[model samples]
Target: MKFQTIFKTAALAGLALAGTSALAHVGPDGSAHHGFLTGFLHPITGLDHLAAMLAVGVWSAMTTRRLWLAPVSFALLLLAGALLAQAGVAFPAIEPMIAASLLVVGLLLAAQVKLPDAVGAVLVGMFALFHGAAHGQELGAGVTLAGMVLSTAVLHAAGIGLGLGLKRTSAWLPRLVGAMVALMGVNMGLGLLAG
Candidate 1:
């Protein structure tokens, strides 16, 4: 089958997954959720978090010289950001930054930009702070932070896998996914503006 066909299928599936949840930071009870399972699922369940995290991995794999550096920087800073938030440190414009991360990461992938490893790591790490801060803001009693970090790592790995596998299948396949991710970012930005 054509790569375009596969991209279409994958994009639809991602959107479907994203559409299942409205907010990234809340549970069904409209309260902050904690614990390992909930933390692990948080990144997967939310549209913003899911797209940004996955895109970071894909971009890292496809562009960075050091495959693991970007992801590791993201993970560690994410933990730091969350820890800071847990400590009552507040970051301004957390949501906007998160949305912008999607936009930037998606564009990087679509453009097939090759960034220096440290640069890429720094870029992703900046976004991870915002993401971590957001998660930290809602952290409650339990081991939720650990679960969220694990989940984020998993999502990143999946993206890296997709980047590696799809690149071998068709060079354009990953670009197509990147475009879709960019569109999701645009939609999210517009939503922020509208709301």
Candidate 2:
């Protein structure tokens, strides 16, 4: 099969599995208490959430080569993290890692530094794991979690799409994204430290 075909198939399969998994884990209330819209909006509702998702996209776009690999790596790793969290696995520094994602992603964008593509992809993948773990912890096992995960994936896609679209507009776009990410990092850090 062609590479493009394979990529599309994989993306669709991932989204479908995530949606089913999310719907399967509904709470004891017997209905989706959060509903679809709320679950869909969950990821983009907060600054931390928005920044992290967008950072994933920006970094993915910046790579310019092996672009799809970065987001795919993030999604797979994120699923692994979510599974770990659901299983009650212990991870010491999840919050700090999430905060660091924002800080690092933002710095990359602001400085317009072009990391080796592999390094950049790995960085985003690592951050995705932490972010996914947090979501799993909050949503638990259910349709809600699946829905939220799908929502997050879509949001990540949006960010990447935006970043790619904007890549030719100006040299400063990445830096601007980086600044926003940095601000979110600071906010996340405060929240993590305070709690």
Candidate 3:
């Protein structure tokens, strides 16, 4: 069961990205790190990426069933997306969609919306693809893709841990965080549009 969980988590996270700006080992504009470090640093370097990825774990734990399914689904689909990017595939409005993902996921968490496990997982996975592709488009030989995936998994675990711990204290806090995340998404989307 533990192995399954780790595998599933890895599969989901492996697909995450740091957006175009954040996909670097050092700071986005800083000196480069190796492939794994670069991949690991990508998501954390970007607020949008961090918020969305963390929300996946929070939402997953909040679900009544299949706690790990959503993140895993995200990881696998993300891998496919990154591969597409590497192959020269392009997606439209990836940044806005990335923000929208935070909005949607956060709102869902805030609202305590429930779906069948598979359905929810699929929805999350769909968003992961967008994020992965956005970052993967800039993927260089500098960072290994595996590092990025592993970092994503770690983020998911952190999210899950925080969600589980917080839920035990005050459910409202998590919901509050969700609402903030949603608002941030809106702000980000609007900024994107304005620019």
The candidate scoring highest on TM-score is 1
**What pairs collide in candidate 1?**
none
Per residue, candidate 2 scores C-alpha lDDT tens digits across 85-116 of 77877556777787787778778777766777
Residues 12-89 of candidate 3 have per-residue lDDT tens digits of 333222223332222122222347777778777777778888888887888648778898888777777777766777
lDDT for each of the candidates?
Answer: 0.78, 0.65, 0.72
What does the lDDT come to for candidate 2?
A: 0.65
TM-score of 2: 0.73
Question: Over the full model, what C-alpha lDDT does candidate 3 score relative to the true structure?
Answer: 0.72
For residue 140, what is the lDDT in candidate 3?
A: 46
Between candidates 1 and 3, name the one with more favorable TM-score.
1
Q: Which window of 10 residues has the lowest lDDT sum in candidate 1?
A: 22-31
TM-score of each: 0.87, 0.73, 0.81
Better of 1 and 3 by lDDT: 1
Off by over 4 Å in 2: 1-39
Local distance difference test, candidate 1: 0.78
Candidate closer to the true structure by lDDT (higher is better), 2 or 3: 3
